[model samples]
Target: MKFSYLGDDAEEVSDVLTRCIGPVRVQKPLNTALSYRYEFIAAGRVAFSRATSQGSLSIGQKGEVPKLLVLLPLHGAARVRIGRDDSLISIPGKAAILDGNRLSELQIEEARSHLSFVIDQGEIFRHLSAALERPVHGSIDFTPELDLTTGAGEILFKLSQIMATCLGDNAEIQELPSTLSHLSEGIVNLLVDTVPHRFSAALTEGEWLPSPRHVKRAVDFMHANLSAPISMTDIAEAAGIGVRSLQEGFKRFKGASPISYLAQLRMEAAHRDLLNADQRLSVAEIARKWGFRHMGRFANDYRKSYGCPPSEARRRLPLSDA
Candidate 1:
């Protein structure tokens, strides 16, 4: 998977990392910090972050949509706060889940390190609902006392292995979706089997929410034709829904507008090509290939979204691949 840094200073990077992984130890009290790195895994739908701090750090606020933020501490203990609740979660193999749509804060003292993985909550829930005999609902808390031993541990371990391998190999970013989906399915199955009782009542309530198959199909179509001049109408027609309905459906199901989602998907595709293309394609060529005609506008949007110039993204591609 391709990696990109969003901040220029070490402190800024630490702050982003803290938000991403909760809290971690910091060594020095300096204003300038390293930039945060975002590993574009699973076609950019999922990402993994590694944060290190010499001193103390903290994270505040919630994400725009619901996501699964999983933290695996690599060093020193840190304090995590969700709303009014707080806990001292320690390091090495310890994990915690925080809801993406809630107000939460995290504070890490000096000298801490951690890894965080972001997953789509809705996707996980849908998979869980299918695996279990009944529907699954409600939020999940990742308390330290909760043991992942019953198959869950194995699944987590496997996921961690996959993440490590992907990062270590500098894997192609395009392969992320399938890779992540495979891992997600395994984890969902484990969760269903181990946390079955926790969701029984919600299942009884008939709140089983299955993502429409069309959404996946739409995603596939968008990915396949990302370089083409596709529009909302095309997507809607492909999904067999009217434009308005399609927009609404995407918002409700995917937590993003259709265009925004398409942009993100296209950007991921372009980024992958930029990183792995053998010909060392020009930025204009890449942008045009990805259906971006206006160089200036594309460059601006790219920087805003990915926090780097398109040229930088292209430069990051493996030299051998280029």
Candidate 2:
């Protein structure tokens, strides 16, 4: 979806923008004339937008449901006011997340080149509920400080990359709906995991239960011996737990059984070795070295995990310095 509005009239521009990026409907008295073009990249529970605006405008009013807007400004300067407090967030590579569910206002001066993501409240709440391991009954608003953090910046960069790659005009638009859905879920997971406040909230709510130390220790053991065959009993013995306990603990913490985790660890180790080895190794030899005795199943699993055949992963990485 795309729209270009030229000419001055704050109300009309705001109306158009609101209809374009909504849930926070704009009021009728917008007072600026702006020329703008907005393109909808990925739209679903989460919507991605790239918009460029020239002119002046004041945006903000009231809204019904909680709304989260992540805005990255590529050019120009602007003074954004949320409630009674105001801050100057400027261009080139700076960004901000605006929570429109609250009382806030934004004054965009001169020109602004921006990319934004509007996240659905229901979807976000569901994610929060799951991550926190408890029912999230209230709305959570992200502060500007949280939005500007290093981790948030990384997420925004990744989001932009995903949007660029998956929603480009040349991309398969027909497949975008499912792609966006998965991408949105990944974004939520990254946010919940990176933000201490959000992580703590999730823990407090029982949405994310603590993993047993033994389970973590078992995983460490498995990773440390990736080239060795690791059985469920071996992992259980290493963790000093019974087989049933080990299985349940791994399931709760890592979301996989010990044997499955071991297989994944071995596959990862084999892939890395193949990528970095100075001398080329046969697929069978590499699989065997990683405790994968069945070459066919190993190759199939590797392809499923890495989205490429094992040989491709080997070819993609440079030879080891050693």
Candidate 3:
């Protein structure tokens, strides 16, 4: 879950930042050593990282970037420019939020050090859509400056610190797939509830009700036999619902079709296996054992679910070194 980078190459650091956050052209004016650490949460949607480098960096997107970047300074200062607007200074008590699709730049005049998080916009949108029981209509125009001294800003800052800091010792928590899933969902929920946005009301209080009992029964069936190759009709028959009703229920309640949910579960199960697998078992062997027939497709799906290749997960040792 946690990886680190320490080197002197600016381009390599830039590439790592591009992978962790966005495409940023980093310039190290002063001769200072670079030290960076990053931890990626599950589902490939969220991550946290820190950089100890003195540089002026430009972050932008040539094409539309489908992600959001949250920048927080723990002990230094930086100036941020959102397009051509007046530059904003961020220090330890404030956080900066930027949409990756927009043209923006972040610069560190001195040897500034800070922490930041990268989030997938589509993943947040999916969760918001599910919680609000409707399609999310627009992008969240977060206040560029977050006052971290009070209210929701304080809560988010503390939670993010806890997550990034505790990752080093939470071996028990890291071993549980459900815990990772819950942690990601909890963070997403915090973001939706705390930030003032277009769907803030629906996020705060929505008219949506929970999914019906039949849907729950179907989900239970899937969980019980997740490794078994199952079909929609099989699930519908077990849940005592027609295929049409089951399809509609999944679309409304799950925000995804039944087939998609099934695939998601399959991928999740495979990912868990990769994490818990023994060193003797190769990634391909584990994938095949879990009924992932196509090795190429399985690798891609596994990467998307866990934010790394299956081989990387297999190579990971226990959290003692995390």
Candidate 4:
């Protein structure tokens, strides 16, 4: 969708911005004539908009935001405050991306013109979760002040301009669903990959360094002591390393946690025993023998890894089918 609004009333501009962005209050200098030119272009969860105001204004909210907003000043300058601690000044080529859930304050001291990107927070999180291959909880916070002078920030700025220009009024891309979907995914993935956060660490590319000697020791210990109970700290200490080092090494070398790697070993051993067991042995017994404390969860993970629940696997004929 593409649209534009030109108005002189501050109240109407305030209402429009609130509806377009989020719940916000706008206060303009008294008796100053409001010259506003607002443009909007939207595709799916992504929207490109630019608003210019001749009247000095203060725009803010008392509560947390519901979506992510990337605000770039094409002209004019402003100071922004996030919650109560972080604050910054933004000008041309310097953008502020508000994806964090917090009260925000933006004071436009002089006549200002800016482009804004309104992205669905849920869509961003879903992309991040998919990239990490894990469930992402809590808010993914980025550096509030984004320096668009170089690197990823510059790319994001240019991409936004292209999206805004392409989807402007009279463009046919609004009718092209596949192209719009690709654009939306590109924008969201850009933010997810470029923005630093807790979840992004897992998605970061690292060099293929050889596994340190400790990793082999840890795996050997796990295999030799599969039936015995052990903790990550215990395994780390036995491998002659700290718990954190072992964790990072395992995540890098093994692509799994030490604890999770132990689970795989236990499950594999249990699978072999189940295949060779006599009729008197039960699936639950085999799982317990491998130190699997929770049969239900173990069954679920086993199903995911082996294509069947342990019980069903045990009941099947032992003859080779392949």
Query: Judged by lDDT against the true structure, how good is candidate 1?
Result: 0.58
- For each candidate, C-alpha RMSD in Å? 10.9, 16.0, 8.0, 13.9
**lDDT for each residue of candidate 4 in 22-85, tens digit (9 for 90 to 100):** 5577777777766888987667777778888786777787344436888988888888888879
Candidate 3 TM-score, C-alpha based: 0.58
lDDT of 3 at 308: 55
Q: Order candidates by lDDT, high to low.
A: 4, 3, 2, 1
Q: lDDT (CA) for every model shown? A: 0.58, 0.62, 0.67, 0.74
Q: Please identify model 3 stretches exceeding 4 Å from their true place.
A: 30-44, 55-62, 166-173, 201-322
Against the true structure, whose lDDT is highest?
Answer: 4
Model 2 RMSD vs true structure: 16.0
Order the candidates by TM-score, highest first.
4, 3, 2, 1
- For residues 1-322, write the lDDT of model 3, one tens digit per residue: 5566766576776776665565566665566655444444433466666666644444444333546777778766777877666568878888888766566777665666666766776567777656754334235666677878898778778767755653565545556666556666676677777777656655545335677889878888887877788898999998899999999998877667777777776776676677686768787777776678899998776655444577766655332222
Error of 1 at 147 (Å): 3.9
- Model 1: how large is the Cα RMSD against the reference? 10.9
Clashes of each: 19, 12, 0, 0
Q: How close is every model to the real structure, measured as TM-score?
A: 0.49, 0.55, 0.58, 0.62
